[model samples]
Every structure is written in structure tokens, then in C-alpha cells.
Target: MKKLINDPKNVVNEAVAGFEVAHADIVRVSHDPVFIVRADAPLHGKVGIVSGGGSGHEPMHGGFVGFGMLDAAVPGPVFTSPTPDPILAATQAVDGGAGVLHIVKNYTGDVLNFETAADLAAADGIQVRTVIINDDVAVKDSLYTAGRRGVAGTILVEKIAGAAAERGDDLDAVTAVAEKVNSHVRTMGVALTPCVVPHAGEPSFTLADDEIEIGIGIHGEPGRERIKLEPADAIVDRLLGPILEDLPFASGDEVLLLVNGMGGTPQIELYIVFRRAAEVLQECGITVTRSLVGNYTTSLEMAGASISVLKLDDELTALWDAPVQTAALRWGR
Candidate 1:
């Protein structure tokens, strides 16, 4: 791979170091173990919010460390779950006697690791609650496997839950808000090209120059199907159709739309997707009260995009508009 780094194994550590130096005013790096938190965290007695996943999705778990967002973010290797030690440490650091809430994405490793951490924290009398985000509508539900994988909708969950915590809501209230938001959210993604993990040093999967993968998961997993590349409008139509049909939004329903690029896709292309998505929603008689389009969550240099629709009530809408100052997202300043 043509990546600038010291070593593949040390990439996560070095990246954490560089991030701390770059944004020291807003974030603080943990010693030895890899955990990030707001520079001024642990607001006495406020519920701590912790979320994390694999390392390739930068500015995600880490970039979201700051006021009105996550209190601590743990990092794992590329597309791997962080171990229980760092997560437990983060839970301890942010637990201000109120409790700690973990916003974990629905992945096998992530679920296992966070479960272990919760068990560890329970031993120390630190109250811990978890809300797994499974908003991707692409995966089929089965009794044997997880229903759906979490995707970009996680960002919305973190923001809304953090806002609730900042408002002095107890652990139960914060978790309730989190669960509510999780239920209201749905996401779907498509990929034009595959990404190469640094350790693997090769493309995770193969795609022709003109082919695309629909319903792609973030970690280079095979999508539901592969098809020829189409125009931006058609692309948006294909991406949005499944999500809309699955939920079947009603008239006068207010929704928050997120059009996220998968690393390599350009903002201009993302905007095109957003425009088409808005048109499709309006035609369906759904009202999009708020829209955000960009590379919020990303695969490692993959050329693709995902769309997430969050059906919002007044409470969720107010929380969505609340102030946030994370490195990856900033609004209502």
C-alpha cells in the first residue's frame, strides 16, 4: 500500500498521537492504552457517553470526542473491535458517579468487546448501559445472526444521546432517548470501489471499473448485489428505495437526511446524490426538515456513499438542533 506511516501495526497509536497534537485544545489522548476524550471531560455527575469501533473510520470514534458528543472514544485495529481494557478505562474515566452509556455499532466483535467491558465495569459498581445501533436496513434479520449492521446512522445517535446527557438526563433517560433514536433511524450504502486495509496491503474486494456494490457494509464486506454504474439520480434512487420501502414513511413526517460519502467520493458527487435523494423523498410525500451531506462516516478511501433517514419527532428534532462541538461535527455554535 502507498500509505505514509511508520509501521502497519503502530498506525493506530501514531495516528492517535498526531491527532492529539493537532487538536489538543479539544481532545486528550490516554496514556499507554488508546482512548480519546474531550480535553475537559467528566463534567461532575453528568452521564459519560462512550462509543467506538474499528480504526479505519477516522474522525468517527475519535473525532467525535468533545462537548455535546462523546465523552470518550476507544480505537481498535482496522475494522476490528477495541479490546475490553481501553473500553473499561474509558468507562472509568468518564463515569462521574451518574453512569456511562456505550453507543456501540452492531458488529460481532464490537458487541463481544463491549459486553466484556460492561461486565468488567459492573464489578466496580460503575453503572453501565449500552445501546447497540443496528440501523442499516440492508442486512436480513435471522434468528442466528444480527439483524442489521450499524452504519452512518451511528453519528446521529451519538449526537442526540449526548445532547440528552448534557441536559442532565439520568442514565435511564439518556438510554431511552438513544433507544428511541435508534428505532427511528435507517441507513443504506453503495460502493463504487473497494478499499485496501493497511495491514492487508491489498484491496479487500474486487470490482470492475464500471461496476458498483449496493448495500455495502463499512468494513469491505460484500454487499447485497453488484451492478453496473448508473447516473447519480438512479444511484440515489436505488439506494433510497430499499430504505423507504422498508419503513414506508408517511406524509407530513419530518426526517433528517444524511448523505455520507465513503472516503474517496467527492463532496460535489455527494451533493448530487443529496439533490436526487431530496427529490425522491418529496415525490414520496415525505418532508425532510433537516439534511446533512458529507463524509461523516467513511470506509478507507472507498469510492461510494450511504444514505440515512431519521424520522424525527419534536423531541428528537430539538436534540438534533442542539449545539455540538466535536472535531468531525460542529453546529449551533
Candidate 2:
């Protein structure tokens, strides 16, 4: 309930305004539909990449709108899907005559809304393709999705897909690369605390000081099970075990690792978890070629972390190394 905001209803809009002010050089914000597009959008002849979801996960769909990444990012209210209107506007705003690709998580609302928007845009002469991210190995079916939920692995999809689009790949090509990433990626998370949505005025879920929820969802949804807290090494093992087994990575496999903090976990703890992750992968003969450790995707103020592993091939490796410049991720300018 103790949120730094003038009004709960205005949180998303005000946050978008703040983002525009803080990163005006890189992005431009629009209203009515409420989307943010790359400052130099409609890149002629290049496929436009667009993604959006609930608003609480900052530096996600929006923070990622920029050069070498997304051209447009639409945001909804906290834990809510953006309506079709904004998504359509976003598609139109960034359509440079080539086409547009929608990267959607496997949430029910997200799928429905994005699909409707895509259908609408296609009718309006904008060629649109979609690649859904369902990399969360945490669940096969949940309250929100029929299959696995899309988690931190989404960041990987965005990065690799964005690179493909930035390199002027056609819509089909970009979508293929994105689909490849989604298929090869897997993620799992644990939570020590929960988040309070501005409207709810209370923590969505709660945990004891000595307990933790494994396979925690980004929106504070319950995980698979709860257990007493363990050491970082054991926690990392439990998380990585399922991911590695699910992909069934082979010896000498190269992979990209992401150790993401859920908003409240500090850098020190994230690095601690990363250390164990790296060690565990090494023991399994997996090479951590590219590793990103930070709060790239997050719950509002939850204290926990998620581990994402992407089994990489030559094509994915090259795309992963490709240049990217965004608010949360930047390299090779």
C-alpha cells in the first residue's frame, strides 16, 4: 500500500511519462493506446519487432525499446494485458511496410489480446507474425496458461529476435529465429517474498521468513511448492536441475545464462546465485558463453531470482553476440 504514486489508476501512464522523460533520446511515448516506440520508428524496409505485457515488470517490454532491440513496446496495467487498441496502434506506428512480429508471453490475456491486435493489424494491411514464449519449465498448465508460462526466457527471445529484425531479416526469418529461441530456452525461479500491486494495496502473496517458493511466477503467483530456505548452491541446483534435464543438454554444449533478480534481491545475492549457476553448468560440461546477471525482468518489489538457460547453436551464438542498445541491456553499441 505504501507506494510512491499520486494515484493507483495513473501508475502505468505516469510511469510511461517518466520513462519518456528519462530516456527521451531513445524512445517516444503515445497515449490513448498507450505505447512506446523507438524514437526512430518505422525503419524503412526493416521488420518491426513489438512486444508488451503487464506493467509491473519494469525494464522489460518498455525498457527494451531501442536500437538493435524492439521498435515498439506496449504496456498494460500491472499484471494485466494491454488492450487490442494500443497493440494495433503500436503495430501501425512501427510498420515500415516490411512487416511486424509480435513476441508474446504465454499468458492467457496476453495471447488473446495480442492475437486480436494482430488480426486487426493484418486486416489493416500490416503483415504480422507472432512467436509465443512459453519457456517456463515451472508448470505445464497454470491459471494463466495452458502450457508453460513465459518467464525470464522472454528476455532472450527479445534479444535474439531483435537482432534478427535489426539486421533487416524478413518477418518470416525474424520469427523463425525467435521461435528457435523459445523452443531451446527454459527457465525456473524461486521467491523469498511477494509484491504488492498498486491497486491491491497489499502483497499479492506472502512467505515466511524461513520459507521459499520454488518455481515462482513473475506476477507473484504461487510456485510448485514451498520449502525451508536453503543455501545458494542448493537453490541454484534445484532450479538448474529441471532446466538442464528438460532441455537435456549434451556435453560440451554452449549456452546463455541469465540470473535475474525479482526487483528486490540485491546485486550481491544475484552474483552469488550466478556463481553457483556457472559452477553447476561447468560441472555438467556446459559452457556459459554469454551470461547476463541483473534485474532485467522483475516483480514490483519481490525478493527472489530466476535462472534462464538457452542452449545455443552457431546461429544463436552469433545473434546473441550481435550489438544491442537498450535501457536495460547494451553492448557493442
Full-model lDDT for every candidate = 0.89, 0.93
**Candidate 1, which ten residues in sequence have the lowest lDDT sum?**
138-147
Highest lDDT against the true fold, candidate: 2
Collision count for each candidate, in order: 0, 0
Candidate 1: global Cα-lDDT?
A: 0.89
Clashing pairs in 2: none
- lDDT by residue for model 1 over 1-333, one digit each (tens)? 688877888889899999999989888999567899888877888999999988888778898888888999999988889999999999988989999999999887888999999999989999999999998887764221276888899999999999999889999999999999888889999999999898899997899999999888898677678999999899788889888877767778889999998999999999999999998889988889999988888998999999999999999999988999888888887
* Residue 147 error, candidate 2, Å: 0.8
Report each candidate's C-alpha RMSD, comma-separated, in the order given. Answer: 1.6, 0.8
Clashing residue pairs in candidate 1 (N, C-alpha, C atoms within 3 angstroms): none
